[model samples]
Target: MAGISKSFFKAEPGQLVESDGELFKITHLMSISSVLAVNIKTNESVRLHVENLVPISPTEVTEKKYEERLHPDLALFSDDEWAEAQRRFQAIKPLLQNPIRTREDAETIATKHKIHPATLYKWLKLYQDAGHVSSLVPTKRGRKTGTKLLASEQEKIIESAIEDIYLSKQRHKPQDVIEEVLRRSRLAKIPPPHPNTVRNRLAVLSPANTLRRRGFKEAARNKYAPILGQFPGADYPFSVVQIDHTEADIILVDEAHRKPIGRPWLTLAIDVYSRMIAGIYITFEKPSATSVGMCLAQAICPKREYLAEVEVGGEWSVWGVMGTVHTDNAKEFRGTVLERACEEYFIDLQWRPVMLPHFGGHVERLMGTMANEIRKLPGTTFSNPTQRKGYDSEGMSALTIKEFERHIVEFIVNVYHQRVHSQIGMSPKQKWELGVLGDANSSGTGVMPIPADPLRIRLDFMPFFERSVQQYGIQIDGISYYDKVLDPYINAADPDNPKAKRSFLIRRDPRDISKVYFLDPVDQRYVPLPYRNIGYPAMSAWELREVQQTLKTQGMRNVDEHMIFEALDRMRVRIEEAKQKTKAARRQQTRIPLPKLPVVVFSKIHSPADKSMNQNERNFGMAEDDPFAQPIKPFDEISIIR
Candidate 1:
């Protein structure tokens, strides 16, 4: 009684209690002022004030029972309690048989159940509303089921804090999130939940989802985004080919002086199905449309003559018209000439999506493999500075450009084509043959044959320029070109725009600037236009620029064609001197084999004077069959006088 309250006594019905050291069992809790009980030893009823009563044993009320007593409005009782309530209803059913219940009947039922008079009517109303005995049971205590702080204003404050402060680029931690949640809750005049509860909620989110919400879209896409697999249609050889460009890791020396030149760029094409190296173009120039064109042309043409030129021991027969060509979003791959060439060959060109490297993985992997092999060579830069820190790549350089090209050709034909690839489980050459032959155990795909006219493909991939035909000839790159076949188109007005000059399509081979191919609109045939200076040496655009630079460095004023050629001859002599003096040049000259001169179709055409000239004099201004030949004098200086 000293510790208990009056309300506590009222809730202790059917509980054992002690009064004046006598144990008693509480029969009923009449009111907060009085409680009725029977003595356990004497079995006599006694009425006592709640202040004089003390509980001997507290009632063992379960969660369900306590909940029922706290909220008696809803149905949330146990099975035994509901059955007892149903029995009480059945007993009162006879009293209200006529369906006309009165106060007397309600009072009688309340007395029979030992409950309050108003509680009986409440039960009857609940029974009528639910039409079931379960409705008579009392509702559970505390907040109702599905009702908590989650639906309260405090939860809204926490969620707003999470969205505004936590899910930001700053990437706040969970403790920071909790602090912000508390601050917002206090600002909104609401109590915040525990920190652990908020942490539990945040734990449900995935790391990717969190990064996507907090970090920028591009970062999230690069780090967490899913990668797409190979294109679905790339199941057969020549079905899909991937093309890409990479700078070789090895530094090369010039053929003439053997001076250390910068690394060369390589444009490579790989067949997706067989994992075969289809085409490759290596040059000291930067990657451009010319490189793409050259690589694709080499891939489409027969490689028998090329193999002989490179002196490869093994057979490299892989060549054909690819069904689809896949490449990156580089400007070189998207050139107008490349698109036109692909269209002419009935090939589909597909550009991979931006920022996705997996689309061109095959070619990229091949480049990596080749770069690894190059690292083993003497003049290799070794990919990065870490691997090349102590090595003197420039000083140890021994291979010239021509020798390196031969080495690459040999590696591709003899080594890479014969080794077993990890993905294909067989050599690239073997897989290619199997795919072409349609072997039952292979991919079972037939290969398309190479085009009938190989020279047409070579002409198609050449870089072109728009020029106007004049009486003198079409001037290109500060050089005048003339041919008798352009007689009809010379001085013609443009049919599309009369005010504008008539433009004709002209294709040039950068490797040889002696002539240009003029596309005749009337007959749709290419005509060769030779340079005005027929005595000029057959040199590349690179060589011409080098010659110009050499003359400028020599303090030559008002440089002309004669001055450029004179400086070029002098530079040739200096290169020969260096070749004999430099250690790199001496080593290269001894170890590397001499390469044959590349043949061009335009070289077949000969002038009248060329036929009369002896073989020694004809070496210059004719095909470069002799590498050590001297430059010929001007055509006017050489007169037969016969």
Candidate 2:
């Protein structure tokens, strides 16, 4: 009200007032024009008045900017850090004297806290609107404005540079490229450009269908340009895991052929909170749910203790639901399967706009790093290595496929991870552990104008019991659950009452009719696989184990209490026997079975009688014991032995 007019339509929010001697010029109005109270000093004693008024002119108005309350050095943050502080701020705001209402208020809060205005706004919005807070921070100021140098010019320069480099197959200096550009411009009647100008132009133009840090950006130039992405220290895991898919070349051995397969798909997820890779999926094809599923499973699955023994500082200490997930707007991702999965997992799929991939730069970078470094293994091929011009998938040159692949995989899992990550300068595994242990928030949802936490994810978020479906209202084990239950929860029962059926919705697997996963409210985790699903659950594992003990107590072990289980037990035993008998020791196994040879005999023929008693006798006399003469002959075929 200091500067604004009383009329609702005439006044603007934050209109500053300037004062002249005879008259007053409205400076600025507070955000809410109706909520102004003025304290005026006619003499020395000031009186407070709640009235419709406008801000006075220059004489009364002064340019006032209080020193941004120096934040606790600990509280100060880069633009990325503001989101988290804001989240904490929202939860703690009720404890503060003022509630946020305007951009100025948010800025003021950021000033006081030594953070970004976007951060404060995100925090305050959650508090005022939904009464819940999110962890995502606002984007940093230095983001790509898309205010790039002219594209046609950029292309012309690149073409000029590449033409020379490709023809010579050598690296060209910046000066050389600039000279070529100038020379061409002169011939073409275009303006001559500076060398630095050409390099700056190149930095802005990232390659199509690829993610690469612009190495040409001179560090000193445009320091205020948007930074890509950042994460606070290992505060929490899964706050905002970024999922993305890109084609990369990884040497995969085809076990069938004992040779390298085609280029592989790289599906990767990075924790925005920790700036760490929570999961990695590498395959030799366009990435699919099968690929994503593997990566996601790794991320959500509990980290085992043996990790510490295998790798240093591998221990993970915390686990739970992440606040939100960021992904690209790919058709496969928009389908019902992924949407339903996120709903069931209590995860929000925050898909970026189509073709606007820089929004997910972190994961994209990880992909580039894995490919660029690992693919350039000793024997790995590139389309234009010396010139850095283009990509060539099938190599014209032959490399030892086996040796190349072995080194590549080994390098990724061990050597690359051991090296410093680009964003945080920490190993991916190390950052990942930090997130899992700390329950920090990392979400873009926090940046929404309104609070997002209180938005109870809709019931239609796949696999929940809907009130419209009756068949969904069946009992499982001892509890009554459904796909959707009627408003009355007609089949619902008291959880405390043993005779009653406790009601809930179920998520049946579309791929397999044999499996159904129940949402267990106790641990906030999914059911371990192979858990039996009854219409009404009889009891938890602890309860079931006790019942088994009781059955032993009653001496009913021989009797088939559950025929279903009894049949399973019998089947299992049979399978085990078959496996044991058919399986033979490696050394004892025969290559092929042999058949016995049939025996056959033929008549013998006798040789003509001859005598060898005398050296030159007219005829050799028939002799029974003559050494030089053939006394008898045996003919025809005979089976040798066996």
lDDT of 2 at 86: 42
lDDT of 1 by residue, 201-282 (tens): 5764555667888876777666654333445477777888999999898878876566776677888899888888989888
Worst 10 residues of 2 by lDDT: 1-10
Clashing pairs in 1: none
- RMSD, model 2, all Cα superposed? 34.3
- Evaluate residue 117 in candidate 1 and report its C-alpha lDDT on the 0 to 100 scale: 73
Q: Model 2 over residues 1-642: C-alpha lDDT tens digits?
A: 001000111223232221121222222232211222222222222221112233332333444421111111111123224334344654445334353356566566677778677755556554443322222233346642233344466558556764554224244555666777777777877666666667664444323211112243444223522223432232445667888876654333332223334444567777775555555555443555545555564454333322321232323322234556777767656655455445334366676655777877777777777667755653244434663335443332233333443343455456655667776677765555443222255321211111011011211122333121133444333233332213344445644443545544344322222323333333222221222243322222223333456556666644333533343345335544543343221111111111112332232432232222233322222321111112222334222212
Query: Residue 494 deviation, candidate 1, in Å?
Result: 4.0
lDDT of each: 0.66, 0.41
